[model samples]
Every structure is written in structure tokens, then in C-alpha cells.
Target: MNKTILLTGVVFGLLAVVFGAFGAHGLEKMVEPEAISTFEIGVRYQMYHALFLLFIGLWTGLKANKKRIVYTLIVLGIALFSFSIYGLALNSIIKFDFRSIAFLTPIGGVFLIFGWFFTGYFILTQKRIN
Candidate 1:
């Protein structure tokens, strides 16, 4: 599980860098300023979550179930929140508008927030440090 989370985090981080470059170079011309900004926001959040997962991977003293929940929520949350924005930002080229379900970004944010809460809970509940 630890290796999986770490590997996933690494992949996410690498992709964030790739997508950010794509947004800057490829998308800058194709999209308007506002769209580019939105795409940047997606990239920023994806990178942040990727780093967050890396931290979670190194963290210790958490129970297995709590770690699972946090990891799952964070992974899914990053996909939901970041991917929705990516789709919306690229709608002009992708020929698909995901705005109909734009509400997911916040829902995904809630999940990410809950993951932090769970991590904090685990830290507080644990007595011994390794």
C-alpha cells in the first residue's frame, strides 16, 4: 500500500508537470486568458495534491483503514476536482462541456478536506511514534 501510494504520487507529480507545460505552451494559444488561468488552477491543485500524497506516503502511526480512506479520497478527489477543470478548460478543443456537472469540483474538494481531517485524527489517536 505504501509503495502503491508513493508510486501513484510520483506519477501524479510527473503528469502535473507535463500538463502544466502543455497548458503553457499548447493551450496558451488555443484558449483565452481566462481559460488558460482555469487550466493553470487545475494544474496547481493537481500538483499540490500530488505532493500531499507524497507526504501521506511517508507519514507514520496511522491505522491501515484510516490510511486507506485518506489515500482513496485524495486520489479520487484529485481526479474529480482537477479533471473536471481540465475538461471544462479544454471544452473548446475537446468538443465537450462538463459544466453540466461542474458541481463535482467542490464535492471533490470536500473529500480532499476530509482526507486531511482523517490524517489529523490518526495523528491525534496514535500514542507511540516510530
Candidate 2:
């Protein structure tokens, strides 16, 4: 799980850098400032969840079965949440309808919320190792 998360993190990190650079340079001419902000919003969520997934993987190794659920939730959350944002941003760039995808963003947000609560619950409920 840790290695899986790490690999995905590397992928996301690379994409973020590329996309961020594109936004900073090329996108400026093609898109309005608000569109750029929206694109950056997607990139920001992707980067954050990518790191969070890595942390969950690391935590899985140090923790118990109960905590593994937390990792699962986070991974799933990132899949749903980050991927939606990426799709939305890409669609925007292509002149596709982004409004339709707006509904999905909140669903993704719910997953992240669940992931966070699951982690917190697992932490509070965990027994310390001697």
C-alpha cells in the first residue's frame, strides 16, 4: 500500500508541476483569470490528496487493521475527488461543458470528509504499542 501510494504520489506530483507550469505560462493566454483559478483549484486538490494518500500508506505500515480502513477510504476518496477535478479542468480547457461535472465535485468532497473522519476515528480508537 505504501509503495502504491508513493508511486501515485510521484505521478501526481509530476503532473502538478507540469500543469502548474502550463497554467502559469500557456494557459494565461488561452484562458481568463477565473479559468486559471479553477484549473489551479483542481491542481491544488490533486496535489494535496496525492500527499495525503502517501501519508495514509505510511500510517498503514505502523498501524493495525482498523487503521488500514482509513487508508482505503483516503485512496478511494482521492480517486473520486481528485479525478473528478482533473476531468472538470480538462473539460474546461477543451470547451466542453464543465457545469455538468460541477455536481460531481461535492460528491468527491464527501469522500474526503469521510476519509478524514475515518482517520480521526481510527487514531482515537487505536491502542498504543508497548
Candidate 3:
């Protein structure tokens, strides 16, 4: 599970960099300034979560099950939140209307908030050795 989390973090981080580059370069010519900003937001959040996952993977304070819960929430959050933003930002170029799924961005944000809250709660409650 730790390995999985770590690998996921690496993948997310790599993709974030790639997406960030695209947003900075290729995306500028294709999308409006506002759309580029939105795409940048998605990249920023993806990078943040990637780092979060990397930290979670290395931390030994949490049990496997607890880590799994955080992992699931974060993964789902990224999929729904960042990816949706990407789709919406690219709506001008893509065939589908990303606005149709705009509701998911907030939903995914909720998941991310819960994941962080749970992590803090679990850590605060954990018994520390003297």
C-alpha cells in the first residue's frame, strides 16, 4: 500500500509538471487567458495533492487502513477536481461541454477537505510513545 501510494504520488507529480508546461506553453495559444488560469489552478492542486501523497507514503504514524482511506479520498478528489477543471478549461477545443460536469469540482473539493481533516484527526488522536 505504501508503495502504491508512493508510485501514485510520483505519477501525479510527473503529470502535474507535464500539464503545467502545457498550460504555460501550448495552452496559451488555444485558450483564453481565463481558461489558462483555470488550467493552472488544476495543475497547482494536482501538484499539492501529489506532494501530500508522497508525505503520506513516507509517514509511519498512520496504520495501513488509515492511510488507505486518505489515499482513496485524495485519489478520488484529484480525479474529479483537477481532471474536471482540465476538461472545462479545454472545452473550447474539446467536443464535449465540460460545464455539464462542473458540479463535480466542488464535490471533489469536499473530498479533499475531508481527506485532510481525517488525516489531522487521526494524527491528533494517535498515541505517541514516550
Per-model TM-score versus the true fold: 0.93, 0.78, 0.97
lDDT of 3 by residue, 84-125 (tens): 999999999999999999999999998999899999988898
Candidate lDDT values, in order: 0.86, 0.69, 0.95
Whole-model lDDT, candidate 1? Answer: 0.86
Clashing pairs in 2: none
Model 2: residues with Cα > 4 Å off, grouped in runs: 60-68, 86-95
The TM-score leader among the candidates is: 3
Q: Could you tell me the lDDT of residue 96 within candidate 2?
A: 68
| lDDT digits (tens) for residues 1-130 of candidate 1 | 7788889899999999999999989987788889889999989999998998888788776656777899999998898898888888988887667888789889888888988888888788888755
Candidate 2 per-residue lDDT over residues 1-130, each given as its tens digit: 5676677767777787787788788887776788777778877877787777667666643455654565566656666666666567566467667667677777777877887887777667668522
Candidate 2 accuracy as TM-score: 0.78
- Assess candidate 1 and give its TM-score to the true structure: 0.93
- TM-score for candidate 3, please give it: 0.97
For model 2, what is the C-alpha lDDT against the true structure?
Answer: 0.69
User: Clashing residue pairs, candidate 1?
Assistant: none
Better of 1 and 3 by TM-score: 3
Higher-ranked by lDDT: 1 or 2: 1
